[model samples]
Target chain A: MNRNRWLLLPLLLTLLFGFSLSLGSVRIPFGQILTILAGGDATEPVWADIVWNFRLTKALTCLLAGGGLALAGLQMQTLFRNALAGPDVLGLSAGASLAVALIFMGQAAGIRLLYEPSPWTTALVASGGCFAVVVIMLAIAQRLRDNVSLLLVGMMISAAVSSFVGILQFVSKAEEMQIYIVWTFGSLGSLNWPEIAVLTATLAAGTFLAIRSAKALNAWLLGQHYAQSLGVPIKRSRMIIILSTCILTGGVTAFCGPIGFVGLAVPHLVKLLIRTSDHKILIPASMAGGAALMLFCDVLAQLPGSTQVLPINAVTALIGAPVVIWVILRHPRMLP
Target chain B: MSPDTPTIALQTHALSTGYNNPVLHLLENMSLTLHAGELVCLMGPNGVGKSTLMRTLAGLQRPLAGSVTLEGGPGMPPEHQVAVVLTEKIAGVNMTVYELVTFGRYPYLDWNMRLREEDKKIIGQAISQTRIHGFTHKKLYELSDGQLQLVMIARALAQDTAVILLDEPTAHLDLNNRVEIMKLLQRLARETGKAILVATHELDLALQTADILWVAGKDKTLLTGLPEDLVLQGTLDEIFQLKGYDLKTGQIYHTAFRNKTVALHGEGYLYRWTRNALERNGYNIAASTPTDVTLTIEPGDRPAWQLRRGTATNLYYSLGELLKALPK
Candidate 1:
């Protein structure tokens, strides 16, 4: 049964990739698509550019961002030993959103900008700000022994950052408001190759670190004291988890503007499907499951029948919220 | 016995265990040894450091000042020498008895883990030995308290350690289940040659089953010896701080009524037997009753004892005793 499931991952990935690439507003023939991807002759320049540059980049962005978010969520779940814990629960994405809003709305009037550079450079600054917030939250969680209090503090931090962004939106001019609103909706069509490279590298590093800590995570499931008796360095393991969560969450938010629900929902879906919490299996399963779910949502977002595209966050919440409600009602004991 | 007999399965040298700066000392400067193939009971009143001692022996808590050495015997690693079952419920309620039992193999398996044939056999034997083989596929939450206790013991058995420690394993069980659990432990000690240590408040049951007793008292001392020796030497009474007993009649009446006394008379084997029965029933067997008391009895071939204003007779003897005393 396990081997068959392992084999099914790549098959599902290929099918999702193929379906995502084929269904768009403009339909390109399979033969022509293949020729264009292979760097061969194209009947028209626009069709070739749309297939190679626009749609393909968007698909790859979904793959990277989805995998990164889900892996970060899984690590947070094990670290907190709470099923509801996720990347957004730590306020990292809210911090990035606030930083980007400050830059886009020209709210940094008094403070001199360090560097006037490209969009990627602005994203780097935002990622650094997000990581700072995550570090502060991690330190606070270490000091507070109670889980509920830690969750409340994270929510308060998120609300504080969100209120600051709301003020920025109120004062901004018309064009800046348009840009901020578009960024807030969240899309996979914005990144270029350089940003994609950075996202991929960060996700790979974070995933590797999480996988290496799988045995320690199993020991921790028994409880903190039992894990200590098993010779796990609790402080060091917690630091590694916090650092990995920051990298994956900060990287995805830097590129995709705080896409919701994929980080929170994909890990849960993978665990339900795989029936195991061992990260050796859960990490890769979450990576593939997250990518598939994101691509499926992306395909829905680009409603081929209509000219309008739904927001990615709206699609995720529409699918994620009902499953979350059902999970809570069915397994109330698993909430913590 | 040799001083260096090498039979000590666990030893503590001046150990102290407590939480947060060691202000509330649960255990203090305690030194003791648990030998192999012995059923040791740790008996104490509530809040007298029984659980704390078990946790320290299991290495779940660090001692404030001492070392616990697990002597490797019969070719097992020091890490595998001790297995503990705590009073707290296991966290994985969804896991089956089989899966939970297999978790004991965690300390032996490698990173890319798979249970070997020998591991499976050991787990199977543990399940059968704990009498949970019939419920091996059932989830933990579906079992009763006694059944769950057996599953926990089965998990500990699968660990294949030389020493087993349990902290109040029978605290939630009924009377029948408590005896069954203690009997299982005693059988395991004799049959498997594992040194079993359990902390419990069931003093009489411990006296029946345990070979040695580790008594923790409020005086901050730990006393260890054979259970009968501890009782015969009056060490158990000293630890409990009990007073007010009649030595000649072997009666323990209320401590507050020290000046109150009752007297009765009888002779021979039947007399001694009846006197012991009266003493156990809370009457001071003496030469005579007080003149102010009301007494009731029926006529018999021999003298009879009875409660005041009650119809019940308290004197009886076996046919053998009667025949032996008949006009010889």
Candidate 2:
């Protein structure tokens, strides 16, 4: 069972990666996709662009975003020791959305803006917003000393930011409102190379920090006092967790919009499947699980054999919400 | 303090420990020492800074004033010497006993938390010593509260610290489990020669098992001595005596005013339980034969009690009916 648990994730992830590469709007044959991946030309040149450019990038983006967000969710869950804790639950995504809403809606309303509406500007603005929320949450975590209260405070910040965003949308231009709405729906296909580079770098740094803090996270499973008693530097560990979760979810939401539910549900699914809380295994397993699930979700969002693609965020929630509910029902004792 | 043991595992000097935001103080000017090979039980009323003191001593919380030091050589870390087993639910942690015990090696492991041969040997010894080797492969969630408590102790043992502190280790266990756990702690202390301090309300178990007692008193003071010494000095009663409970005798003192009197006779466990039942039912126990009602306990396979009231005799198998038949 242990060996199978270890192999199951990477195996599924590889299979899903292959499926994501081969099955999209223009279904490239599996052989051609492999051939194209190996530097050989396909029967049609469009197949190469479809498979290599669009499908391959989308798959990689899904992998990174999914893996990063899941790891962030795992850290949040462990940090708070709350079963329901997720990256977005702390209002970071709301902060990013608020930033995106401000720029997109500001442009639509013909308001004077300091910078042009570009991906880099949006990424920077989103990161700034994410950083702001993370700072507030960290401050609250220090003072509150209770996870539930901190969670509620996060919700309040999210609600407050969302209300402001509502105001921005109410007075915005129709075209700009449409742009903000589309961003909120989220997409994985729009990122070119530079945005992916930014995301990849952030993902690497965040995962590194998280993996380094695995021992501390395990200690935290017994609560903060137990962790501190075990020689874990509580304040330092909290800082690293906050910083890593911010960089990860912030970077992803910057590019893919607040891609929902993947962060919330993926970690729980991994834990349920693997049945271990050791972050040494959990961290990497969750990464792989998140990647596979996100690729699968991306495939669903693509609406195989159809031109009409659904919102990535909608697909995640549509799938994620039920799994969360089922997990809660099945493992009621695990929930606080 | 023992004359032969020169080294103190943990000591707190003039320490004031509490949360300061609201200016509430729990313990003040407390000085105590835990020596090697001694099992010490800390007793106090609820909300009496027992947990706080334990936390402060374990270095989980900073003291408001004064200092806590492990009496090893300089530059040795406090965590390297002290390990704590908290009562807090390890809740939702999905790991086997072996896995949970492995975390005890965390302080000694590298940043990657890879266990070396020495760590594994220590972990194995902890499991066996705690007598949890039978269920080493069992998930913690599957263990009963008593077993879980033992596993936490095992985890602490795995830390290989000189001092082990536990907060209410027997709080949620049954009578047999509680006594068993207390016995285990006592044996571990003597066997490993580690100083073990257990903060608990199990007065009976503490009286039986503790080599010394740390009593949190009413006046922001701490009383430390042998359990018998504390009892003789009335320090245990001063801290643990509640409205209707006596810590020294391990008996429930009934304050209920009874207008009736009953003289209980016979010997052994049956006589003791009969007296308990009579006291619980608002009957004043008399030193000699009563005016009318006299309860005689007879011990046997199907033992019965005879209640004689002015020559009107009644035989009852259970204490319940005998008490019910009493004159109101």
Top TM-score model: 2
Question: How much is the lDDT of residue B156 in candidate 1?
Answer: 84
Clashing pairs in 1: B263-B286, B263-B287, B263-B288, B264-B286, B264-B287, B264-B288
Residue-by-residue lDDT tens digits, candidate 2, B96-174? 8898999888888877888888999999999999999889888877989889988999999999999999999998789
Positional deviation of residue B78's Cα in model 2 after best superposition, in angstroms: 1.8
Model 2: what TM-score?
0.91
Q: For candidate 1, write residues B9-38 as lDDT tens digits.
A: 888888877655536777778888888878
Which residue runs of candidate 2 sit more than 4 Å off their true CA positions? A108-111, A114-116, A139-147, A331-336, B1-6, B246-249, B253-328
Angstrom error of the Cα, residue B159, model 1: value is 3.8
**Each candidate: chain B TM-score:** 0.74, 0.86
Off by over 4 Å in 1: A1-13, A29-45, A105-109, A114-117, A137-181, B1-6, B43-50, B72-79, B87-96, B115-147, B174-177, B201-205, B217-328
lDDT of 2 by residue, A44-162 (tens): 98888787678888899999999999999999888888777899989999999998888888765566564558878888889889999998888887888666687899899999999
